[model samples]
Target: MEAHGPHADDDLVTMLTRTGERVPHPDFDRYAEDLDAATLRRMWHDMTVVRGFDNEATSLQRQGELGLWVQSLGQEAAQIGSGHALNGNDFVFPSYREHGVALTRGVDLPEILRIFRGLQHGAWDPEAHRFHLYTLVIGAHSLHATGYAMAMDRDGLVGTGDPARDGAVVCYFGDGATSQGDVNEAMVFAAVHDAPVVFFVQNNQFAISEPVTRQSRVPLAQRGAGFGIPAVRVDGNDVVACYAVTRWALERARSGGGPVLIEAFTYRMGAHTTSDDPTRYRTRADESYWAERDPIARLDAYLSSLGELGDDAREAVAAEVKELGRRTRETVRSWEVPAVASMFEHVYAEPHATVDAERAWFERYERSFAEQGVHA
Candidate 1:
C-alpha cells in the first residue's frame, strides 16, 4: 500500500504467479477476468515471437550486421501485455527496446532493423501506425508524448464518452529514465493539464550498468503519486497482470482522467545493449532469479494449464518462430546502405539553409575523394 517503500514489489498488482497460478487482486483482477484461453494463448505467441526476433537481432549485432542492438529478453510480457490493451487510435511513444510493442502495432519486423543497420533515419511512417519512431535520447519523448496528449485534449479527443472517438497516448520508457528531468517535467505538465497519457515504465532493474537501487530508494511508481498522478506497480513478468493494469490506465486517461504511471517489476536478462556487458556489474545469481520468472515461459505455463498450449501447438509456434528468425536474418543481410547524401534528408520537416550548406560541403568532399580514386 505504501508506494514510497524500499521494497517496491510488495505492493505489485499481479494476476498470475510465477508458477502460473491465477491469483486475485481485489481491484485489477476485474480488468483481466474477461481474458479467455484463446486470448491468453495469443499473448503467449506474441511474447514468443518477440523473443525470437530479439534473439536474432542480438545475434545479428554480434555478427557485425548491426551497429547496435537492444534485447527485450526478459521484458516481453510487459510490452506485449500493454500493447494488446491499446485501441487503434491510441498512439505509442516508445524508447528504443520495444520490439513487442512494434509487433503489436503491425509494424513490419524487418523495418525496425533499418535504423540499427544504418540504412535509414526512420523506417516506418508514424502516422500510418500511430507508433512513433524509437527515441534513443533518454527520456526526451515523454515531453513529446505529453505535448501530443495536450493537443489531443484541445482537439476534443478525450472524455467524449465515445469509445470509438476518444483516444489516449502511452509513452514507454524505463526505470532509469525516471531519474531524467524530462520525464518528471512531463508528469508535472500532464497532471496540471490532465493530459491523456499513460507513462509506462519498464523497471528492468538497471540503467546500463547502474542498478535501479542506485536511481531510487523508493518505488519509481511513487514519482507519479508525488506529481499528483495515480501510479501502480505490477508484476511485469506476468502478462495478464500487465495487460490488465494497462487497460485500467488507458481507460482512465481516455475518459478524461489525468496521466497514470505504471512501474513494471521486470528484469533485463541480457546486456543493456549489444555494446554493453551486464556481467561486469550484475551477478549470475541476479540473472538466475529473474530467469525463473521468464515472461514467455510464465504465460506458456498458464496457457498449458488451460489446455491451450499443447505439444502440437508448441511445435507449430516453434516453426513460426524459426521462420521469423530466418526472414529477419535474410532481410538484414540483404540490405544495402543508403546513399551518404540521404543523411541530409529528414534533418528537419523542411529544408534549412544550414543543412543545405552542409550537404554541399559533403558533396564537394565526396568529389575530392572521387578525384583521388578513393571512397568517401
Candidate 2:
C-alpha cells in the first residue's frame, strides 16, 4: 500500500513506505551515525521503563492512587522515537497521552502522576524543558504550536541559515483529534505562514470507539495537501523509521522548508484512557493483530539481527525498568499533595482585586473549619 497520501506519486510513496523485510530507511543510517551503542541501549531501556511506568500508573488509578491515568502502553515507540528526535531547544506541544514524550523531555514522572492524581495542574515549567504543558482540550495544542512557530518566525529565530538556532515545534495529537476544527485551523495557519512546525498525528486506527475509516474517506496525510503542506506516512511501530522521519521533518522545518504532516501508522494497544475498555468496542483479534507488530518487539528483532540484543541484555533492561517503576511509584506516593492555597498561586503573577478577595475568603473559610475541629 502507498505509505503516504493519495496526492503523492509512486516515487514519494515508495520513499515513505516500509523499506525491506526489516523496513530500515537510509535516513535511519544517517541519523544512527550520531547515535552510539550506548544511546541505542539507553533508548531500549527508556522504552522499557516508560512502559513499566505506564502500567504502574494504570494500576494505581485502578487502585485509587490516581483519579485517572492515560495509558500509552502500545504507543511507546511513536512517543519515544519522536521525543528523542527533538533537541533541547525544540518545543513539544503534547496531547494527554504523551507520557513517554514527557519523560524523554526530563519532566519528572512523579510530576505527571501528580496531575492525574488531581493534586496539581501542571508540575513543570515549559521554559525549563521546552516541553509545553499537556493539552487535554483535544487539538487545541495544534494552534498553540502554530502560534509558537509564528513567534519564532517573527523573532527571526527560524531559517537563519543555521540549524542550531532555528528550532522546530512538534504538535502531537491522535487520529481522533484531526477531526477537531482547531486542528484544521492550525494546518491552515501553518501552511499559509510557512511555520517551522511538524503536525504529528499518531493514527492508531481508532479514535476512541470510532474507526479511522469513519473519520475520513482518504488517509489523514492526504488532508495536509489540501492545506498546501507536505505530508508523509511511516510505519510508526518501526522506531527507526519514526525517528528518521521526524528528524528529517524537523530539520526541513528548521531550514525554512515549512511544515510537514507525519501520519504515524501505529496502533493503540490499550484503551484510550484508564476509564475506557477496549473490549466494549473492539475484539481480541484486533488487539492481537497490533500486538504481533509490537514496536518494542520489532526493534528487538532488528537489534538481535545485528547481534546487539540478547537474552541477558533484555533481562538487564527489564530489571532496570522494574527498579525505575518502583522508584517512580514511591516518589509519586511520597509527593506532598500541594496545599489548597497553592491554587491561588500561579493564577496570575499580579493579583486582581476580585481574585484576592475570593482567595482571602476561601482561606479564612478553610481555617474556620480547622479551628472548629470539623471531622467528617
Candidate 3:
C-alpha cells in the first residue's frame, strides 16, 4: 500500500469534518462504539495524568531541574490513543515529544524524566518496553522503524494468525519530520518491501514556526500514496478515532496486509520546547482556535453525552492529575546525577583506550570544579 492523491470518493471531506467539527457520523460512531464505560474512564484518567506530567516537566525545565522539555500539552489524544492501540509485542519508535505514548507503553515516567534531567542517554531498555529510545534526530526513527519491520518480516512475524506474535512496528513523528529525507527514504523502503509498519504522523499543523500547509502541497496522507502505502486521515484529538484507526492499521499489517500511513490531525498547544516561544511566530487566534477543539474537552463532551462523566469523576481525575504532577516533581528532584565516570560505560561493550583516557581527563577536570581556590 502506497501513498496516493486524495480520492474524491474516499471520504476525505467526512474525515476532515469529523476531526475539525467534532461531528457525529457513521465513521465516528463506529470508532466510538468500542469505548466501553471502563475504557473511556481509563482513557480520561491517562490523558489527565499525562497532561499533568507534561506541565510539571515543562516547569522543571524552567526551574533548572531539566535541561529541556518538549511539551505534548495539546497532542495527548493523538499519542495516548495510538499507544493504547498497540498489542504488547508491537514495537514503538518515537520522536522526543511522545511522553504520552511512552507512558502508555509502560516506560517509567521517572526514567523518561532522567533523560531530560541530563542523567542518562535513556533510562529504559528499549526491548523491555517494546518502545525505542526517544529519537531527537527528526525523522531518523522512521528508518529504524522500517528496518525493524523488515527484520520482523524476515523473521516471519506477520500473518501467523496469532495476533500477539503477528505484530507490526509503529513509528511516530511530527508534520515537520515528513520533510526529512530519512522519512521519505523510510516510506520508500516500507512500501517497496511491503514491511509491516505504521507511520503515525501527528500533524500538529506547525513545524516549529512553519505551518503544515507550507510543508505539503497536498494532504500529508497523499504523500504516502506515491510510495505505495494506503493512507488515512483521522481526528487526532478524538481519542476514539485515533485508537480505532491505529488498531485497524496494525491489525492489517500483522495479518500480512503490509504497511499503512495515518495522518493524525492535531495541534501543538505549547512551545516546540521550553526554549521556544510560539507567540513570536504564530498568532493568538491560531492558538485559541485549536484550544477550543481540545482533545480532552471533546472527550469530556462525549463522555458527558453518554452519562459517563460527572462532577465527581471530573474532580477525581483532576485531583489525580495534581497528585501525578506532585509525584513527578518530587521524584525528579530526588534523582541523583550519574557519576562522572559512568559516562564511558555504555559507549561500547569493550573499553576503547582513547575513550578511557578521555574519561580519566574528564574526571580530573570535573574534580577541579570542587577544589578549593577554583573560583576562576
Writing each residue's lDDT as its tens digit, candidate 3 over 1-376 gives 1133321224431322323334555644565567687897788778888888888888889999999998998898888888888998799999999988988988877679888988887889999899999888899999999999999989989889976578899999999999999999999999989899999999887788887767776778888889989998886787877888888899888988889999987789999988888988888887787788788877777677778888998898788778878888899999986676887898987879999899989988877977855763
lDDT of 1 at 343: 85
lDDT of 2: 0.80
Candidate 2 C-alpha RMSD relative to the actual structure: 3.3
Q: Which stretches of candidate 1 lie over 4 Å from their true place?
A: 1-7, 372-376
lDDT of 3: 0.83
Higher TM-score: candidate 1 or 2?
1
Q: Which one wins by lDDT: 1 or 3?
A: 1
Candidates in order, TM-scores: namely 0.96, 0.90, 0.89
What is the Å distance of residue 186 in model 1 from its true position? 0.6
- State each model's CA lDDT, in order: 0.90, 0.80, 0.83
| Alpha-carbon runs more than 4 Å astray in model 3 | 1-33, 350-354, 357-376
Residue 179 CA displacement from its true place in model 3, Å: 0.6
For model 1, how does the per-residue alpha-carbon lDDT over 1-376 read when each residue is reduced to its tens digit? 1235433677889889998988888998789877999888889888998888999998999999999998999999999999999998799999999999999999988789999987885799988999999999999999999999999999999999999899999999998899999999999999999999999999998889988878888888887778999999999999999999999999999999979999998989988999898889988987887889899888777787878889988899899999999999999998887788988988899879999999999999889988999963
